[model samples]
Target: MSFKTILAVVTDQAHMSDTLAQAVTMADALDAHLSVVCIGVDRTQTGYYYAGMNAAVLQETMNHAREQAAELATAAKKQMEMSGLRWGVSEAVCQLADMSRYVAAHARFADLAILPRPYGDDRGIELEAATEGALFEGQSPVIVLPEGGAELKMPQKIAVGWNESAEALRAVRSALPFLIAAQSVHIVVIDPPKHGPNRSDPGGQLSQYLARHGVKVEIDVLSKTMPRVSDVMRRHVSDMNADLVVMGAYGHSRFREAILGGATRNMLETSEVPVFMAH
Candidate 1:
């Protein structure tokens, strides 16, 4: 019911400091153990470009990646040493193809995973892979920080983006700890179906469920003013001044979301507030 363990995945050095600060702050706030995984991605794979290249090129690339990963791990450990929280740091030097697997191995052990938003211009391929690994392979809820990293506050006002899908149900369950602790929780449903269980009352069933868990919630049944569902959800979160948003990731398949563009993909790319997601 509570987060006792948290995993933070970091790759590039540019985001290391901010990402670690965010992770440490959350861990301190929740009294949870922090696990830092620093990955130095080796994109130099054996392919057509390297078909005629020397073996030394591959060896050198790998050694450089390991060195970088070790340095990042050392820096992270040094920072966390004075954090006064139970923490550990590990480094991985892996090829791009193997990044997700490595991330999943560590993410599976934690109650929740913290990640930097992997959609901006500065984002790396490894970060995107790590996110997919945590959500799909690790089967853990993830809190993705904004581009510049937000002031890691304990979520006082939380917003839930609801639809009648199993993914949404699972997301609500995963975010129970935060919802229980928040001062106010809002369940926002945009153009809910008129024939489902909640036909007469869109968010009534969910409100009752949360009430049993000692969470008072308000329901907002909104008509989508913008073209995309994500647009309406984003505006609602901003207007409510919610510090955090909880929603299911990729109600459709990942491939479909990537190609056809769904709400989950849009939110990931543009939400200013931290997004808590699970799939």
Candidate 2:
């Protein structure tokens, strides 16, 4: 029902600032074990296996990278020792050029995963490798931290961006542990469908569902005239003074009449609050 084991990813030294610190704080609060995985260079990515490359040069390059990664991992382990929480540190390398899957595999057993949210212009390969692995591949809920990092506040008022999609449903399900304990939960739906029970009342089904789970639920709907789902959700969260936003992470597709990536990406980039996502 609560997070017992948390996986905090460290892409490099920067991860210490952007992710590991937050993970350590949360782990301390939850009395959980924090596992830090430091990623090493992928031989395939550096073109180290190619024929033209000098064998000595490749050896030197790999050795230097290994040394740097090892030192960073060591530093992280030292810090974790002072975190006052059960903790462990390990290292991994990208295999088959699929860092995302590799990263997700590392976090598969964790109760929760925390990773950085890269801005639109900053969508580098490393970002996807670090995030998508857990968000898409792992079963755990992922908390995407804001750029430059933000404190994982004691969530009092939580906001849910509702869109009747599989992804949204998964997000809601993954967030049940948090929702059940929240002081207030707002299911904000932008232009809910006008059909069946929705025509008579939107958010009725979901409200009833959460109510059964002992959550104090509120359904806030915005008109279709609203500019965008992400924009309106932000305004509503600000109005509600919510500390966290819960929503589906990349489950919608073009076939679903919604681009799953669009709204999710927007929230990831623009929200000052942490976004909890599940696919």
Candidate 3:
């Protein structure tokens, strides 16, 4: 399936400008509608009526949030128009419920959601909450762009973390559009020495599979002695100058392992490139 609409979740964060630009560019390329959503807290809802904050203070805070939302919406709309994309900007403020859940619910119909990496103070926690809800709860493919990652070209080289699991296969299928556009595609698999499959080599099997699709593909295997699977993947991503990384989200329960699995967790923490992930 191809993406027909791109949803960008924007907030008062460090990479707002860059993220907005990237979202516009992608929307233009895909000829998709760009929806820039800004989420905030609203003090006017009924649930907060009991809190005894002075009337003036509550009014001031609510007014300030509304003003900020308007400013952000205007800036985002200007950028989208400047990019020559057919776009629509939206804003949502919820006082009675969590903003993250609201964003996730809206994200359900979107083809993809682009989010900024969490950074600094309470911002990190907020970003994480939103990202988790959108990724796990929304059931939509999400792209988490690194800070200051506005300049995104069609990726020349794409790397897929392959383990032949169900999640890996799903990730690969979800990324086929990008793969078809990529100049080079590499499948990196880390094999366990002691207890894993023992064949002459399964890497060639995957390469042959891709070759059938008229894609120039290669496979690389790292030794079991490598420091960590994620570390090895990051090293290769740097060496290969890969612009995009595709991987499966290997997590069972939200609270049990919010950022579960080895490769998913490590790349989320250290990779300098954009990651395309799906559960």
Candidate 4:
């Protein structure tokens, strides 16, 4: 499906430029509306329970955060205009207690959300939570950019992390727009240990399926040495210099990710390129 509105979640962290650039590029390509969200802390509410800081100090802190958020939105708007893409800028005052919830609420109005992967020493937990919120709560497809990667083009080479699971199949179907646009596509079947009786070769099946849809396709079986499916898929992207990776989001509980931490989260944290994820 074509995306008409794209939401990008930005914060005071590293890799903001890359994330902004990617968002602008996608908006330009799709001629879509872009929304840049800056998540910040609200210290006013925190002062009610804390004894160390007073109302005046908390207000000062919140004021500073608001200034920073405005600056970030301004810079992102400038970048989008520089790229010749028309976009609208938006800012929200959020409390840490419900920041993810706020993001999810805003996402309800957009077609997609672009987020940065979890990395570095300090912001790892926050990134993880935000990404989880985007995937589980937003209930929309998310595009995650790597930590320090270059901007992605039209994704000439695309990799789909395929399994027999319903989620993986849904992701593949949701990514059809990109697949149709990509010059080359690879369907990677991540087989489970101790193959079962009904475990048909997904790679071959998917290749044949896409060929009918006019996508130039290839299949590759990962070696046994590469155990976890997510890790192997990421390694393939790096080795092949793929521009985009597509996979499914897996979550067992509201607060927990399932086995392998889900392909979406794994590639987001470790990939060297862009990843398109859907639940």
For residues 1-279, what per-residue lDDT tens digits would candidate 3 score against the true structure?
678888888766455688887787777777788788875556464556546777897788777777767777777777777777777888765542466687788678888887776533435455766676676678777777875553665677998888767777777777777777789999887773445573556556667767777667888776655677888888888889899898887544545445444667667767788888888
* Positional deviation of residue 102's Cα in model 2 after best superposition, in angstroms: 1.5
Q: Mind giving the per-residue lDDT tens digits that candidate 1 earns over 1-279?
A: 899999998897898898889999999999999999988889885353555778788788889999989999999999999899999999989899888888988889899999999787788878888999999999999999988746886899999999978888899999998999999999999998979677999989999999999997999999989999999999999999999999999888889987899998899899998999998
Tell me the TM-score of model 1: 0.97
Model 1, residue 248: distance off in Å is: 0.4
Candidate 4 per-residue lDDT over residues 161-263, each given as its tens digit: 8766676677777777778888999887665435675355546667777788788888876664565667888878778778888887763443354333645
Backbone clashes under 3 angstroms, per model = 0, 0, 0, 0
lDDT of 2 by residue, 1-279 (tens): 788899987765755665788888778777888888877654445434667867787667667657766877888888877778888899765442677777778778998898877555654457655777787677778888877645785577899888777888888888887898889999888887767557667777889999999999998878756566778887777778788899987655523422334777778878878899888
Better of 2 and 4 by TM-score: 2
What shift in Å separates residue 42 of candidate 3 from its native position after superposition? 5.5
Off by over 4 Å in 1: 46-49
Q: Which ten residues in a row have the lowest lDDT in candidate 1?
A: 45-54
Candidate lDDT values, in order: 0.90, 0.77, 0.73, 0.73
Ranking by TM-score: 1, 2, 4, 3
Compare the candidates by lDDT and give the number of the best one: 1
TM-score of 3: 0.84
Q: Looking at candidate 2, what is the lDDT of residue 81?
A: 77
